[model samples]
Target: MVGVLAAAVAVLAVVTGLNLVLLFAVIRKLRTTEARLGTAPVATLPKQGSEIGSFLIAAEDDSMISDASIGDGMTVACVMPGCAPCKTQIAAFRERPRSAPEKTVFFVFGGQGEPETEELVTSLAGLGQVAVTQTAGAVGVALDDVTSFPTLLRTEGGRIAAVGRTWEDIGAVAVATVR
Candidate 1:
């Protein structure tokens, strides 16, 4: 009986050691992925009054969203189709005042072939223009140095004026820019 008890203890120890090793491996992998995502430093983005760099606007036609097109100012929202926060942000953006539709633009991450992409475009069309592009090299993401979803930027006179992560931030910028 004593020998059997010792064997069980040895098996438990071995299993525990293996679990620890696997856990550490998973933690290391997660850290690597996080580092690669290039999430921007907290609240330090779109430096106020900085000129935005040029980036291609994904569209069916040969058009681009540039500072030239938005002469006065515009509100740009960055969204990922499958992201929960993005969905919430979209809904909030859609509910913005009626006068804001013309001044808004949505930069949707990922290609336009998916059904969700189509739905997103149709929904946002009512609010403003939609530009679909992959996460890499996307104009809004690149210009704003965004590392997370639902980043909104307000521009005035071809320069960034405000940056935010929530609908309230967007509203505040909108009101501020108008004045």
Candidate 2:
């Protein structure tokens, strides 16, 4: 019985170490991929339809939502930090005109560390007027399932008109759908 217990403990330790190594490998791979596949800012907004609506965003500082309603002719750009794709998307969104009837909202999705989050918000503030919200718990995670990072969802008149993987694709789809 003593021998069996000792063997079990040794095996467990080996498995744990292996798991840690695998996790590190996976993380490194993801980072490399992101670095290699850098995206450029897109010109002009994507196509969208007449289904704009209100989308609730949990604010980080305040209890109320920052930006929820897009109205009928407005556009909303949602962004997550630490995602290379998201960073590129943000740059594109930043270039857009404030009076251009499109609204961009920045949310802190699961990525990077707290310091990175602060930097992202600060950088976005420099871009132009935008709504920054902080989501709590699994709600943000759940929202991510529906619209993952580097994703752009276009809502017109309170309904989802188009959604895409990259900001350019989504923006194009949204712009087209809106008109």
Candidate 3:
């Protein structure tokens, strides 16, 4: 009876060890699979990059401008509303060469709800900058890998030059770019 009890304890210890080993193997496999999928478990915003494509967006003026219609020689700054930094950048942008005929920075407002989005437009308009309407679909296309709000994309010479989630001294950056 004593020998049987000792053998039973040894078997239980081995089973526990095997279970731990299996758990580690399964975890390692899941990590490897995630790596292959080109996506992290956590969401990350996209970094500054070039234009993936040009597409037209609707606006309050009842007009439309397709991405292809944008002149290659011009630099377009597509902006969204309700972004405090965006408002400051827009204010500073108006004073920069970006407003010059050659640069042509276009404001594009995109938000989740119509009322909130309209409020953004009103706020920007009050600041004296004309903004176009960016539908939810267009916003999705414009922002690639953007996980949060307040997105600013700079397109120069027909390609995306830089993009950021915030302004962080954007006036200096804008001035430096056009000058």
Best by lDDT: 1
Ranking by lDDT, best first? 1, 3, 2
TM-score to native of every candidate shown: 0.63, 0.48, 0.49
- Candidate ranking under TM-score, highest first, comes to 1, 3, 2
Write the residue-wise lDDT of candidate 2 on 91-155 in tens digits.
66555433243244445554444777767767766442344544443433323333446556555
lDDT, candidate 1, 51-124, per-residue tens:
77767564433457764665455777877777788788777655543236567777887666898877777667
Q: What does the lDDT read for residue 84 in candidate 1?
A: 84
Misplaced by over 4 Å in model 1 are 1-45, 58-63, 173-179
TM-score of 2: 0.48
Residue runs of model 2 more than 4 Å from their true location after superposition:
1-63, 66-68, 96-102, 110-113, 126-144, 171-179
Every model: Cα RMSD to truth: 7.7, 10.4, 8.2
- In the predicted model 3, the residue pairs found to clash are 51-160, 54-67, 55-67, 56-66, 56-67
TM-score of 1: 0.63
Q: Rate the local accuracy (lDDT) of all candidates.
A: 0.69, 0.53, 0.54
Clashing pairs in 1: none
**Local accuracy of candidate 3 as per-residue lDDT tens digits, 1-179:** 99999999999999999999999999999999988986745534445455645456654545555555454434444556566665676666555444344335355556535676676566544322344644446544654534444455555555555555543322224344433
Candidate 3 matches the true fold with a TM-score of: 0.49
